[model samples]
Target chain A: MKLLEERIRQEGLILSAAVLKVDSFLNHQVDTQLALEIGREFGRLFADQRITKVLTIEASGIQFAMAAGIALNVPFVYAKKKKAVTLTEQVYSASVHSFTRQETYQVSISQQYLGPDDKVLIVDDFLATGAALIGLVDIVNESGAELAGVGCVIEKSFQEGRGLLEQKGVRVHSLARIASMSPGEIHFVDDPSPAYLVKEML
Target chain B: MKLLEERIRQEGLILSAAVLKVDSFLNHQVDTQLALEIGREFGRLFADQRITKVLTIEASGIQFAMAAGIALNVPFVYAKKKKAVTLTEQVYSASVHSFTRQETYQVSISQQYLGPDDKVLIVDDFLATGAALIGLVDIVNESGAELAGVGCVIEKSFQEGRGLLEQKGVRVHSLARIASMSPGEIHFVDDPSPAYLVKEML
Candidate 1:
């Protein structure tokens, strides 16, 4: 987390008060070593839970989900943004609205992949507006699976995302929690003793 | 490679002569250990290339690209299928026609991530029509990067993808090369001594 926050400070571009671009290393162009470290952090944080599967949306979240899957030694499922030609079976789906794109799209996963026997841990690249994450949680609930919690690589704490997830009683953890940001400056929430590091030391 | 071949025969659904679905393990619901093995196989195949980076398209390719990046110990850059709000800078773009989706979309990569000094290896889940792979090759050429080769998890040998890539004088390697497939049967090209395996034993 300290390493991730440092990388954000060094390379993250604050386009505006609401926009933080980490394309240099996080999403567009990825740092494989850093991604692996992030996965280990997630694994340590959720070590107490018996996670059967890791879930995420397509495109951006795939890498992190894959990393978490590697760390947890479990399979990861990505919900497709649209139904492709090959996906002909019955699916569990939820409609999500993207504030950045200003469009709503249906996210779906095959019914066979998740059911009452599964324990799901949802992961993603960013947590802002909480629209997509909430959609995933709904799908997890619809599939009759037990929801372990949500994990995010970077979180915009100033937004309503954390509040909304907390309202639903979903345990949420993010590596880098941005307290505030401007055109040329950014701030992160201070944590003197992080839980993952404490666990690592023990 | 034997493990991958076995997985396909056991789990892959031959939807039609043209479509073989491995979503249960390769793409949608991914088996992390298998993916890591696939990556290690790619690493063994391209170990001599000194690849500076790995490249692929968004969504599905991220997992394989990440795997390859891990095996190669290099970063990866996934070209965005569409221009997002945060991607405000100049990019190298290409248009790709998807035979399955029956539509053409623009794929773009940031100018900052690639250059002439980089040796890029492109990885993907499938190499069927080669439309998407061709688009990525063009982007790599435009970026002035030296392409080591293109690696695919599965290749439909009956398709025109290999022919097209070969015509461009690009090296192509696939773990499981299917000669043909139908409702309940699949055939693979027999290779008694794979080149990568020979290199590994040496």
Candidate 2:
């Protein structure tokens, strides 16, 4: 987590008041070594849980989920944004509103991929408005799968993401929590909670 | 390679003449254990190349690329299929036509990710028409990166994918090469090459 926070500080580009571009290492281009480290850490944190599968949304979240799957030695399934022709008509679909894109798009997972017997952990690159995460939880619920928890590389705590998930009683773990950010500086909130302690350690 | 062949025969679903659905273990729901084995095989095969980075296209290719990255201890970069707010204006973009989807889409990689000093090994789930593979190759070329080769989980050799890639002078290593397939039966191509034989020994 420290390494991730450090990388964010060193390589993460703050594009605006609400956007942080991590194309150098996180989303567009992946730092696989760091991803594995983060994955192993998540595996350690959720070792007690019965994680049958790791679920996430497509594009950025796939990398982190893949890394966690490797560390936990569990299969990872990602919901696709675009409906491919191979996907069947019977699917677990949810609409997610992208704040950046300013558009709502449907994310879906085939019913055949998930089942009632599975215990799933959701993973993603960033937690902003928590729309994508909510969509993932919806898909998981549709499959009758148990939602173990949610894991994210970075979470902007100043946003409504954490509060929304907390309202639903979903346990959220983010490697780095940004309380506030401006230009080249980022501030962290001081707390003894697990998420805060993780940030403090970072 | 035998493990992969056996997996295809046992678990892969031939939905129709055009679609071979391996969603149970490959695309939709990934088998981390098998992915790790496939990763190790790729590592062993491309071990001599000294690959600097593993290049792939999102979101299906991320898992296999991550597994290979873990085995090789190298970073992996996946091309983004859509233009996000975080991406820069200047990028190496290429059009990829999806046979499954019956549509053409743009796949782009940032210039910062690939460069002349980097040796990129392209990884993907399936090599059907080789459109995605060639798109990746174009991105790598635009960045002036060295192409180590291409690796695929399954190759439909009868589909002209291998021949197209070969025409581009890119060496491709497929775990399971299918000569042909149908709803009733699937025929696998004989591994006449030494590399495939070595992969089988693994």
Candidate 3:
């Protein structure tokens, strides 16, 4: 997490109070080594759970989810942003509104890939409005799968994302939790609890 | 490549003469280990190219591009399907027509990530009509970056993807080259020139 925070400070561009652009190394263009390290961090955090699969939305979240899947040695499923011609089966879906794109789109996963037998860990690049992550959680719940937890690489703690997921009793962990940010400065929440980490056995 | 071929034989659903769905393992629900191996295969093939970066389109191509980036120990960039608010700067953009979706969309990458100094290896999950891959190739060319070649996980050789790319004088390598497929039956084109591999001198 320290490394991630440092990288954010060095390379992350703060466009505004609400916008942090990590396109240099996180989402648009990625540092593969850093991504692998982020995955290891997620694996360590959720090591207690018997995670059967990693789930995420398409495009941005795919790399982190794939990295987590490698770390956990499990398959990762990404919900499609659109129902393509080949996706001709019953699906578990949730409608999500994207504040960035200013649109509502349906995210879906085939019923054949997930069900009651699976234990799901949801992962994504950023946690902001919580709209997208919440949609994934709803899909997991609808599939009758057990929700292990949610893991995010960068989190906007000032936003309502963490609060909403915690309200659903979903365990959440973020590598870099931005407390506040402006064009020239940024702050990260150095929470003592690190509540997302599963407690060790006595 | 044999491992990949076997996976397709066992899990791929042949919907028609053209559509072969491997979502259960390749795209939607991804097998992490297999993906890693595929990346290693690509790395081995393109070892001679001094590839500074790997590039692909968003969604389906992220994992494979991530995998290739890992194998090559280089960063990867995925072109955005739409221009989000954060992508406010000047960008290298292309229009790609999706045969399956029956629509054309603009794919763009931040100008900050790519330029003349970088050597890039383009990667993707599938090479069908080569529409998306060609768009990426054009983006790379527009950036003034040197392209090593294009690497695809699966190729429908019966289609014009290879021919189109070849016409551009672009080197193409696919792990599994399918000659044709009909329901339960599939054939592979075993080419003598596996040109991607770097030759060794005694």
Candidate 4:
């Protein structure tokens, strides 16, 4: 987690009050070695869960989920943003609203892949509004599988995602927890701050 | 490669002569360990190339790309199907036609990640029409990067993909090459077919 935080400080670009661009090494273009380490961290964190599957949404989350799957030695399933033509079968689905994309999309997984027999660990790149992660959690619940927890590579702790998942009793872990950020300066939950997070902790 | 061929024979569903679904392992629900082996196989095949980067399109190709990146001890980059809100910079892009989806989409990679100094190995889950792979190949060319070759998890050898790639003077390697398949029967190029393959070779 510290290494991830270090990468975030060194390479992460703070675009605005909310947008953090890690395209250099995380989502868009990836550091495969770093991704593997992140996976190992997730594996260590959730080592006792007896996870049968690792789940995620398509595109961004696929790498982390696959990494987690590699670490956990389990199969990873990605819920497609749209039903592909070949996916002609019963499916478990949930709708997710993307604040960034400014649109809604349905995420689905084939029913044959997950059921009561599976224990799931959902993973993703960013946890902000919690919309997409919540949708995945709903799908996991719908599958009648035991939900172990959710793992995120980078988390916007200021956002409502963690709070919402906590409300659902979902154990959540994020590698980099950003406390606050702007164009030039950034604060992490782990950063020693004369900032609000420390005051909030008080 | 034999293990991959065996998995295809045992679990791959022949939805049609053209559509063989290996969603249970390769794409949707990925067997992380097998995917790792596939990556290692790609690494072995392209070992002589001294690849500096591994590339693929997002969603499906990511797992294999990351796996290859792992085996080769390098980074991987995925082209985005759409320019996301966060991706405001210039990019190298190419348009692709999806036969199955009956649609066309632009795939783009940031201009920062690839360049003349990098040697790329493009990896993907399928080589059917070769449309997407060709798009990626063009992107690599546009970036002034050196493309070592392309590695595919499975190849529908009966399709035009291999021919088109060969026509472009690009090297192609596929773990399992299906000579032909139908509802119940699947034949690999490696299969001792009383089929067209042996005769064509003769």
Misplaced by over 4 Å in model 4 are: A194-202, B194-202
Runs of candidate 1 with Cα error greater than 4 angstroms are A191-202, B191-202
Model 3 stretches with alpha carbons more than 4 Å out: A191-202, B191-202
State the C-alpha lDDT per candidate.
0.90, 0.84, 0.90, 0.89
Q: Given candidate 1, what's the lDDT at residue B97? A: 99
Model 1, residue B156: what's the lDDT? 95
- Listed for each candidate, the true contacts retained, as a fraction, are 0.91, 0.88, 0.94, 0.90
Clashes of each: 0, 0, 0, 0
Candidate 1 chain B lowest-lDDT run of ten: B193-202
Better of 1 and 3 by TM-score: 1
Best by TM-score: 4
TM-scores for chain A, candidates in order? Answer: 0.94, 0.92, 0.93, 0.94
For residue A3, what is the lDDT in candidate 1?
96
Residue A154 C-alpha lDDT in model 2: 91
**lDDT score for residue B140 of model 2:** 87
- Model 1 sits at a Cα RMSD from the real structure of 6.6
Among all windows of 10 consecutive residues in model 3 chain B, the one with the lowest summed lDDT is B193-202
Once model 3 is optimally superposed onto the true structure by TM-score, how far is the C-alpha of residue A86 displaced, in angstroms? Answer: 1.4
Q: Compared to the true structure, candidate 2 yields what TM-score? A: 0.92
TM-score per model over all chains: 0.94, 0.92, 0.94, 0.95
Least accurate stretch of 10 residues (summed lDDT) in model 4 chain B? Answer: B193-202
